[model samples]
Structure formats: C-alpha cells, structure tokens
Target chain A: MDVQVYRVPMQRLIQGNGMPQESDHGVAIVGMGIVCSIGDNIVEFKESLKKGVSGITRLADRKGPKLSVDIGAEIKAFSFLDRLYRYSDIPETLLQKARHCAQRSPFAIQASVLSALEAWQDSGMVARENDPERLGVIVAGESTTQNYRYGLHAGFETDPEYLSPRYALQFLDTHQVGVLSEILTIKGEGFVVGGASASGNVGIIKAVQLIQAGIVDTCLVAGVVADLSPIELQGFVNVGAMVRGNEFQTPEQASRPFDEQHAGFVFGQASACVILQSCDVATERNATVRSTILGAAMNLDAVSTTAPSASGEARAMNEALRRGGVCASGVDYLNAHGSSSPLGDATEVEAIKQVFGDHVSKLRVNSTKGLTGHCLYSAGVVELIASVLQMEGEFIHPNKNLENPIDHKLRFSGARFEKARIALAMSNSFGFGGINSSIVFQNAC
Target chain B: MEKENIFSVVKEAIADVLPDVDTEAVSIEQNLKSLGANSIDRTEIVMSSMEKLGIKLPLVSFGGVENIEEMVDILVDA
Candidate 1:
C-alpha cells in the first residue's frame, strides 16, 4: 500500500505574461489619495515625492515620560474639519455626511475619512455614480485606536461610569469601515485586514482579488494611520525597533534606510487610499486609469517573531512577478521596504538579490520610508502612491540621507533626483511576524 | 439648585453634544431625539449634565426620562 503525491505544472498555472486573459477583467487603479505629514492630498504628495521632502521631525504632542524615541513624522496641526472642507469639489451633501459622521470621531477615523473622500473624488465616481451595491470598502489597519484609548484611560480610571458612550463604537478598528462606508455609501462587502507593517499591501491585494473575482466592480482600500500611543512608542524603543532621533543633527536625518549608519525605523503617520476598479468598468465609465495592478502576492514565513526572512520576501517577489506574467528583467524600478532598520534593510537587500540577480545592476532602487519615516501600517500604500508619482513624472526621488550605501552592488538612488522612465515597477513590504507582500504595477498611460 | 438653573445646565450639555442644535430655540417640552440627538448623544448629554452639577446617579435613574423638563425635574429632586 503506497501513496504518491502529485504536483501541478507551473506553466499551466501561468498564462501569457502572468496577466489575466483578454476575457478576464484586469484591475486598474483609477484614483489615489493621502493625508500624511508631508502632504494632505495627492497633488501636494506628488510634489513632495518629486522634491524628496522628509516629514520627520521632533514630536510636538508628546506625552508621558520622555522616551528615547522622541521624534517621528507625526501629522502636525491636524484639524479634521478643516481638511474635510478643503475638498471644495465634493458636493455639500457628501461634506455634510462626512462632517456629521467623523467630526467627533478619533484622529485615525477622521484621517481615513478624509483620504477616502479624496480617492472617491479623484476616481470621478463621486459624479458618475456607480451602483452602491457594486462598491466595496477594505480598511487596512488593526489596533488603530491605541492613542484614542490611551487618552480615555485617565478619565476612565477616575470615573468609569462617565465615559462617553461613543467610546464603545469609536474604539473598534472596524469603526473605520463603518464610518467610511456611511460617508461614501458603499454597500458591497466591507471588512478590515491587518498584516502588521504590511497591512496596506494586504488590503490592496485583497481589494484587487475582490474586483478580479467579480464580487464588486469597484473597491476602495483605505490604509489607516498608525497613531501609536506614547506607550507603543516606548515599547518600540525598548525593543530596539525604533530610532532615538537625538543622535541626528535634525529629525529629518533620523530615518536613513540602507545607509551605513542606519539604526532603527522612525515612526511615521499617514492615511492613504486607492480606488480599484475592473478595467472593463473603468473603460465603460471613461475613468482615467492611473496605473494597472499587474499582480500582487502575500505570504507568511510561519513565524510570529519580528525578525525578517529573506527567503520569504524573495518568494513573495518572485510569485508576484510570475502572477503578473512579468519577467525579472522587465521591472525598471523597485520600491523597497527599507524601513531604516539595519537588519530589515540588509534582509531586503538579500531578497532583492535573490529575486533579481543580474537585473539588480540596472534596476533603480529607492526607499520611500527614507522620506516618509516608515508609515508602519500604511507604508505599503504610501509607497505605492510614491512609486506611481515617480513613474508619472519620469523621475526617481532621491534617497535623502543615503550618504553611504550599505551594499555597493545595488543601484540605490543618490542624494539627488534622477530622470528615468519607469513603465513597470515592483513594490515590496515585509512585516513583523513573518508577513511578506509584493505588488507589481504597470503605468497605464 | 432651582429647576430653571438645572434646565440651563442640561441645555448647555445638549449644546455641547449636538453642535448643530440651536439651544436658545430649544424648549423644555422638546425631547433630545427631536433635536437630532442619537441614543449615544442623549446618553452623553445626561452624563455631562450630571457631572457639571457635581452629582453621581446610576444611568438607570433617567430611564423614563422623556422631555427636557422631566430630566431637569429629576436633577432638581437630587
């Protein structure tokens, strides 16, 4: 009595160039929006990426005992109502709905609403109006209410009975899904997905799958801001995962990914959103396709620790390229998950080498985290937007503080911008707990 | 505290909870729901009014509360 194991051939699994056949619907990114330390909207964000602006700075609203990590790229001077009203093109009814729903909500919820509205507006869906039942919302975050909860502890400790009733609803992470869906009137499937630091990529990948599966014609993926409380900041500092900015002359220099003196990641805050629609629907509505999502892949290393795994990351990249029907040589740019952690940077370099051996010499590489300060949960989405902006502009952003490269073989961007045309690019995001994700995008134009 | 004073405190709480409401135009005969207060908003207003008056009562104490006058009467009795 013997048993034999069978395996399916790889060629059958992969069709031409890894893309869905002409009969199948392809996913297209028709709109993008963001609210980060560097920019409050797509236009401003694109400009910041072009100039390689660094948003890291000394924390202005720090509370509790002084931690070793006192500086980060926090969204400063934030007023939710002010940002909400700035979208002048949005109809008054929608603005009123947003204000009523999120005016009294936490910072994280308000940021997500703003970014989602921007993406909705950019997609022209605001005016064209697809069936609400055909739309879906995917929130990319977990434990997003840390700061809001931390702020309530003092009052709660003194008088638990007097806690605001709204706390019961606002404290949950899925509250973002509820608030965004209410404001945008999305009625299809909606849920939250988290993958530690790779949460944004996870959310995007899920949205693309939903569109491809025909469950929805359009999906909105919102990456919530990682509004870590002071305690979380201290936790990262104690675990040696975040940098103490006092060592640098200025806060802007604290996040230097792939540099010889790289230490740990500097925390950043951002809420990003992208509207993904099937190519058939987008073309039918005559929506402008910002980029086509050729493929996306996510895998776990079966470990729960915070250590990085090169093989896992390499597998994700290779699988993404294969699923997209793309060859290693076809990729012109690599938006790396260079979170400024020494080990993280080194591990990603090894993964890139494994995935693109000879192509590493010609493939231009840069880390958006060097400028955005590692937007934690939203870093993947933020970097995806950054890559598209660079591709559209036909230029590569400078690796702001890369004075000394860790590995000389890789073509890391210099201290200044470089002009290059990128028709196709790959973005990688690796998270704690062995979560690895990679996404491939091709310029739609 | 007089009933009128308690009513003003409750009115202030209502104003704080419902930003769009015109408290000056509010009448004691009006209920919170009519003034656009959801269940949460109504609970928040009650808690806030109690806190401002330096009183502690179980939320159930206001279980049968209907109008602004009835809520003010309960605070007046306290």
Candidate 2:
C-alpha cells in the first residue's frame, strides 16, 4: 500500500478551523501510551522529564555470568494488564495456548499490550461510536528474538516433542502484533515492521499512510522491545556496543548524549504506542487530537550496514520537512536520535547540520535517551511523544548530564525551560540496518 | 499427608497461577474450570504445585483429571 504522507499544505493543516476537513486526508495522533524504565504513562513520563530522572540502573534479574557493565534501564513497577478492560475474547484463547507452551515468553508482548491499552483509553475511542472493521494495529521490533532460546535448548538436548504447540507462535516476529489486534479486536490490517531501532517511527509513518489513504479510521501503532537476555547482552558485548559504565559515578549518568564525555547507549526495554486517525475521524468522534503527523520519510543509509550515513539521514530530514510543508527554520525543536554511541551521535549531529544548515544554530535539540536510556525499537515513538509533550505541556526537557558540550554550535537545550512556542517539531530515528526515518508533527491549531 | 495440608499446597499453586482468584472460597472438590482456569492454566497450576511439592507430574493422569481433587489425589499418592 502506498504511504500518502505530508502532502497537505502547512497552512491548511494548522488552520484546522475546528471543523472536519471535507474528505480529510491528513492523519492526526489522537492518543499515546508508553511503559519503560522511565515512567508508565505520559503523565509520569512528563514528571520524569521535569525531574530529569534517569532510569538506567544495574540489571536485577539474570541467569549468566555478570555482564561487564551490568547496567540497564529496568522497569520496576507497573499494573498494566490489570487496569485494562477485557477488550476481546482472544486473551482467553491466547492464555489457554500459552499456558503449557514451552516457549520462553519475551517481554515485548506484555509491554506492547500495556502501551496499546493505554493509548486506546487515552483516545476514548471505545466510548464513542466507531467502526471496529476500520481499526487496525501494527507493532514492530525484534531485538529480543534471540532470547527465545529455551525451546532451542530443550529441542537440542532431546527431541522436538519437548516443544509445545505455542512454541513457534510465542517467538515469531509478527506474533506480538497479533496480540494487540486480539486484545483490541481490531479487524483491520495487522502486522509487524522491522526497521531495527527505528522500528517505532517506521510503523507510525505507515499507520499515517493507511489513515491518509482513507483505508482505516484508526491505526494502533507500536514499537516494543524485551531485549534483556544473556545472549543479547553477549552480542552487544561482542560488538562493543554496550555502554561502558565504568567511568560514570553512577549508572544513570552513563548515557550522556552529545556531550564531550560521550560513551554508548544503555540497553533498555520499553513499549510505546499511539492511536493515529484521519483528522476527520478524530474530529467526528470529538477525540482529543494530541498532535498531527504532518509528514514522515523513511530511507536506507546504504553507505554501511551498521554505520550511519549522514547524507541519507539528511535526505530523510529534508523529505519529511518538505512534505510537511514546513521550512527547516520553522522546526522549533528537534528530537535527535542521539544513541550516545561515539559514531551514531556524532554522525547524527553532522546530519542535522547538513539538513538544517543556517537553521542548525536556531534549533533547540535534546535527546530523551539521556533520561530513558536507548529503548531500541520504541526510541523513536518515545522521543516523538517527548516532542509532542513539549508542545502540550509548554516545556522541552533538558539534555541531562550535558555539562560539557560536543559542538557548542548545535543549540542543545541545557536542561532549561524554553517556554514552548514550539509550533512544529521533528523527530529522527536511525536503526542498525541503515534505516533512517524522520517524522514532522505540528501542534494542534 | 492430610487433605487439608494438600489443600494449602493446592491453594498456593493456584494462587501463583491466578493472582486475582479468591483462593479462600476455593475447595479441592471444585472444578478448575469453575475457577476460570483453562487447560493451560490447569497445567500451570499442576506444574507449579508439583514443583512446590518437589514431585514430578504424571502428565497423562493430570491431563485426564477434571477437578482440583484429582490433582490432590495424584500428589497424595506420590
């Protein structure tokens, strides 16, 4: 399906006139949900942003030799499933299937369900009349696929009889997406997106397309990861991608992005989801449109499989801004994909300079990763929410631990409240598979 | 072992599987299905209860049982 994005002129979108545009093609975000080490929902996450609380800490539960750094952004408390009203009958069937299933259940499924449920409630779509047939769900991420090794171990030691009926279903990449549709009873297109770390934005971008094309009234988009596993840890160790927390006084101080004392990203698990609907559908239902996705673009770096391509990143940025009909200077805030890895952060800064040019000095940029750690697939979604919150709450969070600057030329919001006159915001996400995605959102007029 | 002791163990195991279930009103004679448990939940209850008791579940007999009493009977025999 063609992804129709950012084609509407900026003025038409901004001057919404409080009336549903006749044949509204633009898509708006009606609700959002998130669960990570930082906070459970947007309210709590906003508080964390205000306090500049870093969620990274020592890994608590494990089953192997201690990791060299042994640090992670661990979610300690939540009552996600308990709070959600039973929205579908599939949960009963899924529970029945999984009870005896030998598959090592990954954490992303639960995380996605919680995040999606919150978004569903936040939108209040259930209270109003809506076409269930027009509701769709799309979830993406695969960082934890390696953690489903229990069945492999059992099969290798003995025979395949040890594997249960739900063994394969439990770990399939698209299985978590099905869980969301089942839980929500969304009968529309449901699938998974695999854009590596940029998975969340990629999925959201696609949902906007489906909505703009009038294919679905609402799309449940999510990016989730349950990536804390021995094998996953060892892989990061082998690649030297794990954050070196030795020099830091504390684990929370490890992920200081765009700082002179930059290291690597802390491995964190989280789920972020949003409900996207056509502006007309949202208005017709009288739902609170959090923000509108003015435009989005996804491209491959194609330079290196692992290393970032500044040219590709810049192109994506230009495309999204152009499609959104917003000028580079118009973007008041930038949610940069500052993973804090030496190469990724530096490359992203260069890409920002290349795309923004003279506007680079005018931009107030910050990386939420400094607070929440790198939440893998959900980083883009989480960061996008942070950007939206800045517009809604009248504050952009500080780049915590940014005492020393990487390039003073780039105006990093040094933990100061810039009374958000933010009319437009841009979020960038780059994944390991050379995926570059940029999304532009406009404050609801 | 007393059936009352077996009831305590069974209650604990079921509680582990279903945190929201009221174990106080539950009796060993009640059907697992009546407790809102499915086949898999029943298996989990059995496995957890056996693990707590430090005994291996006879999967065949466990599969054939329809109620909590059958589970206790298996444990008492073991």
Error of 2 at A147 (Å): 5.5
Q: Give the C-alpha lDDT of model 2.
A: 0.76
TM-score of each: 0.95, 0.82
Local distance difference test, per candidate? Answer: 0.89, 0.76
TM-score of chain A of each: 0.95, 0.88
Pairs that collide in candidate 2 are A398-A415
How much does each candidate deviate from the true structure in C-alpha RMSD? 5.7, 6.4
Best model number under TM-score: 1
Task: For candidate 1, write residues A108-167 as lDDT tens digits.
Answer: 999999999999999999997569998999999889999999988888898888888899
DockQ of candidate 1 (2 decimals): 0.71
Q: Is the docking of candidate 1 incorrect, acceptable, medium or high quality?
A: medium
DockQ metric, candidate 2: 0.12
Q: List the lowest-lDDT window of 10 residues for candidate 1 chain A.
A: A1-10
Q: Any runs in candidate 2 off by more than 4 Å, and if so which?
A: A1-24, A78-107, A145-169, A173-175, B1-13, B19-31, B46-78
* Alpha-carbon deviation at A101 in model 2, angstroms: 15
